[model samples]
Target: MAQTPQQRRANERFAKNEAAKRGRGSTIKPKQVTKSPVSAGWVVVLAFVVCGGLLLELLRIVPELWTSIAAMLSRLTG
Candidate 1:
């Protein structure tokens, strides 16, 4: 059987009252302070190492990219 609109409204009002009653007992817990496992100097060093590796890889690929571009241009012109 289907419920009438009045029954649905009664259920909504009952839920709202129950939720408001439960909301009054809430307390906030203090947040804990934590320290980093690695030092700041190590983090900076790791960043530089990663950047240097990327730079080296880019330098190695640039010449091959230029060669590929040249090949494409030659094919287009021919």
Candidate 2:
């Protein structure tokens, strides 16, 4: 459903007022922001560990590809 022009204007005004109120505040409430989709250095390290585990499984299935995978990862990182 779409809002009427007047309804949209009222909402815009409300948002502006809310923003101004937030801007004027010196303390109390923290900023409202979305949590990171993937957060922290440790999370990235964990992701790498999971990927390495998957690759290890793949290497066991296709042992001949280990050298190629190592070279690929080295080239990718470098």
Candidate 3:
């Protein structure tokens, strides 16, 4: 059976990949990924900044929250 151009190209790619897997023909190397230690440090810093901001917000709202709770309790009791 005659193969179309696309089918022939696909067959060539398949053969190349198979050859690479078997350590034959032109071997294709996978790209390597390397992470930077500085990036991990920056991630930790960002987490601390976010946590600090949330803590500050909670601290700022505590006084108002206490007032609201006190008023609610007075209404319920008196």
Candidate 4:
């Protein structure tokens, strides 16, 4: 379907108005946003806390396990 002459003129007027607005710098440039380094730091801190807790749990369990194994070994050998 072809646009009528009136529709064509109206489209041209809209395009020209848009161009004029841009030429006059009616729009502002958006500011560059900076992300905080604190989020990365928090991630590292959380990893350390979780790993430390796991290590502590293992440390608590391993000695008791070792003693039990050693006693069984001694009884078997004796």
Local distance difference test scores for all models: 0.97, 0.90, 0.93, 0.95
What's the alpha carbon RMSD for model 1? Answer: 6.9
Q: What's the CA error at residue 28 for candidate 2, in Å? A: 18
Per model, state how many residue pairs clash: 0, 0, 0, 0
For every candidate, C-alpha RMSD to the true structure in Å = 6.9, 15.1, 6.9, 6.5
Q: Residue by residue across 21-75, what tens digits does model 3's lDDT show?
A: 7885556799999877678779999999999999999999999999999999999
Best by TM-score: 1
Model 2's number of clashes is 0
**Candidates' TM-scores?**
0.56, 0.34, 0.49, 0.48
> Cα lDDT for residue 31, model 2?
78
Which of candidates 3 and 4 reaches a greater lDDT? 4
Q: Which ten residues in a row have the lowest lDDT in candidate 2?
A: 58-67
lDDT digits (tens) for residues 1-78 of candidate 1: 887999999999999999998988878889998999999999999999999999999999999999999999999999
Tens digit per residue, CA lDDT, model 4, 12-70: 99999999887895667899999886798899999999999999999999999999999
Worst 10 residues of 3 by lDDT: 19-28
**TM-score ranking from best candidate downward:** 1, 3, 4, 2
lDDT of 2 by residue, 49-77 (tens): 99999988887978667778989999999
**Candidate closer to the true structure by lDDT (higher is better), 1 or 2:** 1
Which residue pairs in candidate 4 have backbone atoms (N, alpha carbon, C) closer than 3 angstroms, thus clashing?
none
**lDDT, model 4:** 0.95
